[model samples]
Target: MADAREPVVVIGLGRFGTALALELAERGHEVLAVDRSDARVQALSGQLTQVVAADSTDIDALRQLGVQDFYRAVVAIGSELEPSILTTSLLVELEIEDIWAKAVSDHHGRILRRIGAHHVVFPEHEMGERVAHLLSGQLLDYMPIDTDFALAKIRPPHSAVGVPLAESRLRSRHGVTAVAVKREDGSFTYAGQDTVLSHDDTILIVGREADIERLVTRS
Candidate 1:
């Protein structure tokens, strides 16, 4: 976990980078926003702690901006593979400790990891899959975990509502694990073996995609 008190540096001021920097600033974390373009740095100057116009791939520039002092850094260069990889490499060499990079493809992700990025994300692919799951109408919301499992928000089955979890046979029948239960009034309770389901309850489940599909289809 990132320490909120430490200043965070965000390299690149594209949509993802700008959004992340603004959100971190709003959460009370000091943020240093950097971009190669004047427009991007200027657009976010008033909202973040500070904004700098510089090329992140230049080691001297990073040092000049004191980027190495921050433990948390996000390389948000999208599509530009060369700059993104170079920035990640520079951060790693500086031993910044926590490096997160956005990658457009598996190869890009692999390169980032090989160069020591702490975390790599594919925002477009992830969002596309999440939207697909919601479009299926069976899932209220969904997030992918690895390639096999997911955390899914779904409506409790009509047959299972008003019944205790022990009697639901969800685990035995559908091979899914329930994580939490959300009530209509917005209160939440950890799902347990004896918890009773309500008509307005939502359940968060983790399971295999095939099994999750079967569970929802059966419900």
Candidate 2:
């Protein structure tokens, strides 16, 4: 077992996995990049701390490489359900403290969580929503608070500009609340009932997704 201080083990050398490993290694982490393909491992060998071509589903292979000693493990094989799940299970059995898995679908995400993955990310679905928000014109950024609620940074609609939160009745009429005002000058102000909105300012709003869509549509 190599010294395991501040180490991260990354399984799968696909685009997402390779990029993650590179970034972690760049941030001064001891990254062990694992993949079943020798070509994939060789491609990244010069960039990361270590690269190994080994099947992660094999528990003995993982044990030999001291996979359990790493503080975090990332299973980035989204499409390969079998290898991904098996690798996650092996990591769990080895008692890796933190496991982050990339999941292809909602069902896949649930299974990852059920098998002791600390977090599961749905990349394609999340990217689609983000792109939609960017194309919508009014919303600058969108972050999901829950299945039904979101936090949005948006440009104030023409109808909303020069209006105070009290008159806008955003909370009552739209079921949205202004959290903060980010001015064009790159300063932020805490929002209050009396805070007036401006066309140039970006406002952070928290509300149900439907209410947020309504606010944007009103623009």
Give Cα distance to truth, residue 136, candidate 2, Å. 2.8
Error of 1 at 150 (Å): 1.7
Top candidate, metric lDDT: 1
Model 2 residue 162 CA deviation (Å) reads 2.2
Instruction: Identify the candidate with maximal TM-score.
Output: 1
Error of 1 at 40 (Å): 0.6
Q: Which ten residues in a row have the lowest lDDT in candidate 1?
A: 1-10
lDDT of 2 by residue, 1-219 (tens): 334447889999999999889888887888889999999988887788689999999999999998988878999999899999999999999999889999999899999999999989877787788778779877889987777899998987676678787888788878888899988888878988888888889999999999999989987
Write one digit per residue (lDDT tens) for candidate 1, span 1-219: 556578899998998898888888888888899999998888887787699999899999999999988889999997899999999999999999999999999999999999999999998899998998889899998999978888899988776788888898888878888879998878767999888888788999899988888888877
Candidate 2, 148: how far from true, in Å?
2.7
